[model samples]
Target: MIRTLIGALGGLVVALLILGVLATFGVWDSIGRVASILGGLVLGMVFGQLGIFIAVWRE
Candidate 1:
């Protein structure tokens, strides 16, 4: 149970770190696509992992 929580939090932190790096480098300044894609990808990964955790816990 704790491992699952750590995994989820770690995933979220990593995702935010990626976003921060991109924003810091001004990579999304001229393009909106990258920001949107990154946001969706990170969020999807976080939620996906959450679902997996819940399923495993239930079993």
Candidate 2:
């Protein structure tokens, strides 16, 4: 459980780091700043729920 928590936190840190670097380099900015954030949030939520659904189904 602890390892899972650590891995998840590490993954989140890496994801944020990549996003920050991309935004800093003007990559995400070119995609429309606010739109990128909104899209990321929506996609993240959808994918997260999909994972949960699959996990439940497999049980």
Candidate 3:
């Protein structure tokens, strides 16, 4: 359970980092708010699942 929590947090950090990079490149301006949010949500879930998989696999 602790591993799962750590993995999820790590994933969220990664998602935020990617979003930050996109924002730096002004991608958010072209995409609009709703689309950007949806993109972030998708990224979060994908990365979160990947993180969880890796964590569990390591066990």
Candidate whose TM-score is highest: 1
Model 1 lDDT tens row, 1-59: 77877887887788778777877888866447776776788688778888988998999
Cα lDDT tens digits for candidate 2, 1-59: 34444554565666667666777878854647655675586567556656665676677
Summarize candidate 3's per-residue lDDT along 1-59 as a digit string, tens digits.
56666666676777678767777888865546745675678677767777777777888
Q: Say what the RMSD of model 1 is.
A: 2.0
Clashing pairs in 3: none
Q: Which stretches of candidate 1 lie over 4 Å from their true place?
A: none
Q: RMSD (Cα, Å) of candidate 2? A: 5.4
TM-score of 2: 0.49
Candidate 3: regions farther than 4 A off:
30-59
Q: Give candidate 1's whole-model lDDT.
A: 0.78
Better of 1 and 3 by lDDT: 1
lDDT of each: 0.78, 0.62, 0.70
Clashing pairs in 2: none
How badly does each model clash, as a count of residue pairs? 0, 0, 0
Question: Residue 52 in model 2: shift from native, Å?
Answer: 10
**Deviating ranges (above 4 Å) for candidate 2:** 29-59
Candidate 2 residue-wise lDDT at 5: 45
